[model samples]
Target: MTARETPESIVVVLGTRPEIIKFAPVIRECLARDVPFTLVHTGQHYSRELDRVFFEQLDLPAPDVHLDVGSDSHGRQTAAMLEGIEDVLVDVEPDVVLVQGDTNSTLAGALAAAKLNVDVGHVEAGLRSFDREMPEETNRVVVDHVAEYLFTPTEETRLYLEREGVAGQVVVTGNTVVDAVYQYADVAAEKSTVLDDLELSPGEFCLLTAHRAENVDHPDRFRSLLAGVAQFADLTGHEVVYPIHPRAQSRLDEFGVDVPDEIRVIDPLDFLDFLRLESTAALAFTDSGGVQEECCILGTPCVTLRYTTERPETVYVGANCLAGLDPADVVAAGSLMLGKQPDWTIPFGDGRAAERILDALTEVETDTDTAAATVTPTETTATETLQ
Candidate 1:
C-alpha cells in the first residue's frame, strides 16, 4: 500500500464542554494506542468556568491548537472558526479531521477539512430536526453532507443519511454520550456534593437547563419558560435546580427578565456535578439536545422545552415529551411525565461506543491500505508490460 493513500494522522476538533465530555474517551483511545493525532479547540464555548473545567474534570490533554474564537453572531463565529480551523489544518496536514455534534465548531471543522482536500469524520451525524430555524439543525445538515465518514449514533440516523443520499460511509457507532455517561456518572456520584450544597434530595427535585438561543434570547419565550417551570415547581412542590449558562444569565439581565423565586438558579456546574444532578433528578426540563439523550440514558423523565427535537427516539420510547414554550403545555407535560414509570428501554447504546468508534476508524485505515496495495501492484504491472 502507498503510504500516501492511507490515513496517517487524525485531527480531533471540538469547542464546548459537551464535545469535550463526548470526545474524552476517543482522545484517551488515541493516547493509549499511540495513534498520531492532534486536538484542536475552537473556543466557541470560551469561558474558563464552562470550558476549562470540563477538560480538567474529564482528564483530557490540552488542545494542541486553540482558535480562541469566542462568542459572536452565528455567521461571524462560524466564519472565524472556519478561517482559524483551516489554518490549523494546513499546518497539521492531518489525513482526517474529526468533529462531534451539530455546533458551529463541528460545521467549521468539516467545511475546512473538505475544502483542504482532507477526509472529514463527523461523529453524531445524520440527526434531523427538520427545523431550519434552529442553527444546530443547519449545522448538522451541512456537516453530514460534507463529511467523508458519518458516525451515526443509531439505526434511525443511518437511515436518515441514506435517505439524504450522503456520499459518506455511514456507520452506527451508538452515541458517545452513552460512553461518557457510563464512564462519568459513577465518578460524579462519588465526587459531587451538589445535592447537599443545594439542600435537595435525589428523586425529589427537577433539573432545569435552557441555554439555546431560541429559548433564552427571546424575552417572551424566556419569560414564559421560566414561568412554566415556576408553576411546575409550585404544583409538584419540588425545587427546580437550574444551573445558568453565562449567556443565558446575560440575556436575562439585558431583557429585564426575572427568575421566579421557586426556580433556584445556580452557577454552571462542572461536568461531574452536572452528571450527578442529571442522574438523580426526578425530572429534567431542558432545551439542550445532549440533555435529552442523557435523561433517556439515566431513566430520568424529560420535558423538552423546544417545539421540535432531533432525538425523536426519546419521545418514541416514552422518555421525553415536547412541551415547547407554552407555560400551560410545559406544566401539563411535566405532570404527565412525572407520573409515568421509568421503564422505557434506552435506545442509545450499551456504553461501548467509544471503543466501537475507534475500531471503526482503524478498520477504515486497514481497508484503505489493502485497497491501495492492490491498486498499486496492478498499475505497476501494467506500466511494465507497456514499457
Candidate 2:
C-alpha cells in the first residue's frame, strides 16, 4: 500500500440506491472532519438506475473499488458478494467497515468484516419485520448481530435491539434516509427536468416503483401490481410515472406485460430527481423500503405494495399502508392517502443520524474498555414473518 492507500479509517461498504442515500451523509461527516475513508461498491444492483449517477448526484467520491457483483438469485448473488467483499476487506484492512440496511450486500459485507475482526458498524441497524420468509429481514437481523456498532434511526429500532438481547453499543441517531432527502431534495428540485419532460406536475400524478424480490420474483404478482397501478391511473385520469428497475423490466418482457402506453415507463432518475418528483407528487406506490421512508419524510403519503415492511412505523403512523398484491387494495389505499393530509412527523429520526453514529464510533474506538463492557453475548430472536 502507498501512503495514499494508508488512511487511518475507512467507512467501507455500500450498494444499492438506499445504501448510497443513507451513507452519503456519513461520508459527508467523515470528510468534514478530515477523517480518512474509502468507499467500496459491491455492485448488487449494477444498473445505472441503482448505481452510477447516484454517486455523481450525491457528490460522493468515486468508489476506490467496485466489485460488480451483478444481479442473480438470492443465494448466488449473496455468495458472490461475500467473496467479493472478503477480497476487498483483505486488501483494504479498513479500521471500520460500515454497511447500511438489509440488502444481501450489507449482510455479506458485515459478516465478512466481523469474521475478520474489522470492527464492523451496521448503519440503519436494529430494523426488523419479524418475518423470516423475507430475505431482507433475515439480512438485517444477521447484520445487527455481527455489527460492533448499531446505528438505529429511531427509538423503536433501539427497543427492538434491546428486546433481541443485543447489548452492543446502541445509539439513536436519526435515520439517514431523512438526511439524504434533506441534502439532495433542493438540488434535485432545482436541476431535474424530469417533471417538465414528462409533462408532470405535483398533485396531478402518482409516482410508482416496484422492484422488491418478493414482488418481482413471481410473474403473476408482478403483473397484478403493474396492471393495478396502470389501470387505476387510467380510471382516475392520473398520470403515473413508473421508473421500472432493470430486473423488473426484464420480468415485464418475460411475462409479456406490455408497458401501458398511458403509463410513462422511463429510465430511472438519479436521487435528486427522484426526490424532487416524489416531493411534489400526489402520492407514491412502490415496493421499495427506502422510497416508503423518503415519501414519508417528504410528506407524500405512500402505498407500499409489499405485505410487510421493516419500517412498520410508517404504516402504524398512517404515512404509508401495506396494500399487498391486490389491485383493489392498492387503488383504495392510493386514493385514501392522496386525499388525506399526510402526517409528516415520521417516527424515524431527526437528520442527525450520521453525526450520532460517528460520535459513537469515535467513543468506541477511543475507550476500548467501555466499548468492550457494552458487549455481552446473548441469544437473538429471528425476523422471518415478513415474507
Candidate 3:
C-alpha cells in the first residue's frame, strides 16, 4: 500500500473527566510520536469544577475547538452537540475522530464523524450492560457499529463485538483508565491536600458518587438512594464524602430533596483530588463506570449503585457488588464492604492501553474502496428487486 503524507489531523474529543483521564495518555502519545492532532471540547460538562479544572491541573493541551453545548434536555443536549460537532468536522476535516466511553458526547462525536464518512475510532469500546433502558448501552452499541477502529479495553469486550458481527479490527489494548490511575496515583497521593481539607483521616470515610443518567432521571430511586446513604452514614458514624455531579445537584434541587447533613455534598473535584479521595477512602459507593476500575486498582472495595455494570470484570473478581437503586441494599452493601478485605482483581490489563490503541490505529489496514464496494452491491440488489 502506498504511504500517503502523514494525516493532516486527527480529532480527540472530551466532555467529561473520565474521557479526559482515559484520553490523556492517547493525546500525549500522539504528541510524542509527532502525530498531527487536535483536541475538541464538547462542553457536555460545563463547570470549571467539573471540566476545566481537569484540563488545567493535568496540563492537558488546551482544546483547539470548544463547543460549549452546556446542559439541556437529553435529546436537546445530544442534538446540539451533533450540529456543533459536524461543523467542527467540516472545518478541520480530520482523517479520524477519537471518542472515549459511553457518554452523550461520545455518541454525538462518533455520529457526526461517521455521517461525514470520516474514519471514527472509539476508545474503550465493547462495554455492554445488556440493558436497553440505559442510554449509555444504546450509545455504546451504536458507536461500535459505526466506528472504523474499535480499541477495546478487555478480551471480554473484544468477544462482545465479534459476537455482534461488528466489522473492523477489535484489539484488547487494556484499559486506559488503569493507565491514567497508575501513572498519576502516586504523584496525586503525595501532592493532593484533599484529606487535610476535608478534615478526615485516611480510611475513616466512605467515598460515594451517583451521577448516572438512568439513576438521576428517576425521582423515587434517586431520593431513596440518597436517604439510604444518609442512614448508612448516620448508623455507622462514618462520614460520607460525595463530590456531587452538576446534573445530580439540579435533580436534588428540582425534587426538593434535602441532602442529609451527615452526607457531605462537596463540589466536583479534579482528577488528583478524586484519586486522593478514592485511594484513601474506606470504601466507595458509586454509579460511575470509571470508578469501579479505579477502586479495584487501588485495592479499595466498592458497591456499585446500578443494577448492572459494563465493567463486570471487577464484579466477577469480587471487588465490586451491584446494589441497584434500593436504599436498604445500599446501606447493607456499603456497611459490609467497607472494612472487608478486597478479593477482586482487575481483569482489565496492566496500564498499556494507550500504547495498544496507538498501535492499532497506526496498523489498521486502510482499504479506500471498502465503503464504496460494499454499497455498490447493495444498491444493485435494491434496483434489481424494484424492476
lDDT to native, each model: 0.85, 0.78, 0.81
Q: Would you give me the overall lDDT of model 1?
A: 0.85
Ranking by lDDT: 1, 3, 2
Pairs of residues at least 3 apart in sequence or in different chains that clash in candidate 2: 130-385, 131-383, 131-384, 131-385, 131-386, 132-384, 132-385
Cα TM-score of candidate 2: 0.89
- Residue range 1-387, candidate 2, lDDT tens digits: 001222377756887878888899999988887778888888887874447788888888888888888888888988888888888888877888899999988988888888888887888889887878888999999889878778777767878998998745776676887777767777887799888888887789998998877888788898788777877787788888888788888888887777666578888777777887888888789888888888877778889898888888788777888888887887777777875576345566556667666667664332323322232112210111000
Would you list the clashing residue pairs of candidate 1? none
Clashes of each: 0, 7, 0
Instruction: Provide the lowest-lDDT 10-residue window in model 1.
Output: 378-387
Give the CA lDDT, 0 to 100, for residue 322 in model 2: 87
Q: What lDDT score is found at residue 204 in candidate 1?
A: 92
Sort the predicted structures by TM-score, highest score first.
1, 3, 2
TM-score of each model, paired residue for residue: 0.92, 0.89, 0.90
RMSD, each candidate, Å?
Answer: 10.3, 7.3, 10.5
lDDT of 3 at 332: 88
The CA-based lDDT of model 3 is what?
A: 0.81
